[model samples]
Target: MDAAIEQPTVARLITAENREVPVSATLRYRAHDPLAVFVDFPAEAALDGEAVTWTFARSLLDQGLRAPAGHGDVRIWPYGGTRTVLEFHSPHGLALLQFQAAALRRFLQHSYQTVPAGQEDVGAVVERGLSALFDEV
Candidate 1:
């Protein structure tokens, strides 16, 4: 299984005044199971990095897309970097979480590869991804 997602990556929250704040220890997702993501932080954390998980179910995830919101907006790969970005906007502010592309791909390859392109549902895709991780190499 990929361990990178479990590691403490930096979670930055950009305020209205363009200030960066650390709101969580790490924003984690297990395989393709966005719902299984663990958001470790305070309720009063001010910003939300985990909201990106909802985008998968909401059909808002894309390589270079932004969804407008009240506070800021959600953006994915705004810079077209090697890393996949998940940006979340809340009434409080914006949260940005970066994921290493390689680890993320490995973590979810089974889901994306096994399912027909466009036929992926959140749960089945995630189950396949997790099974791949648990399966022997």
Candidate 2:
């Protein structure tokens, strides 16, 4: 008997938005799966820092990626000050997402500025950003 192997799905990097920040800043995404996605933004563009790196990793785990279908989990890791890893896990399989340093910075800024009122969803802004990256708009 022959064993079948599942091929790893290639994740696509997407830019949600771009702006000049005395340099340049952008919001990007890499889809790990239908349930999980990765997001990135610049920390400093000129020089990525630890705080910026940590914030982006935390936000992706704390926000961004979600299992709208209700069947997966998103995981994140900060790689030095240049990148963040987002992983999605489900009964079916796993997916990995990566974000650029600049994009992550922009995302963290947007995420912190907006806070929902009582009974309102706080994740709406993040969701919209993700949707934009996915071209769901």
Candidate 3:
């Protein structure tokens, strides 16, 4: 974590489908790789501090989702629950990565809307959600 990288920020936004959701966005990086920017999100909104961190990490490893170049990888960790690690590769390096809290909120909200309610195995849904987001952009 760098002194310049601010703490995670939370915001509410409407998705493409017009659904509103809350999203928390954070910028992170390794001390040695301060130039690389890693963006992280909570697995579930409204989660307890510990559980939120855990799911964030779990979502990465279990989901295998990666961000586009210049956007640092995503990481999830646990404060209480089992930490999940979801990392995205950025060949262009972290300096190119920018944290857009609004975009993240939209991405997440759209992801949930696209997912079938009550259906687990969100990996596929996540992929679809991200693809859709990129397409719209």
Lowest-scoring 10 consecutive residues by lDDT in candidate 3?
A: 76-85
lDDT of 2 by residue, 1-137 (tens): 21111212222232234321232323322222212223322444213342121113333443433321222365555555665555555464554445553454454443333321232243654686688899964
Best by TM-score: 1
Per-residue lDDT for 25-79 in model 3, tens only? 5644232222133455555642344322312332242233233211145542221
Error of 1 at 109 (Å): 2.3
**Which candidate number has the best lDDT?**
1
The model with the greater TM-score, 1 or 3, is 1
Cα lDDT over the full model 1 = 0.48
TM-score of each: 0.40, 0.35, 0.28
Give the higher-TM-score candidate: 2 or 3. Answer: 2
Each model's lDDT comes to: 0.48, 0.37, 0.38
Question: For candidate 1, what is the total of clashing residue pairs?
Answer: 0
**TM-score for candidate 3:** 0.28
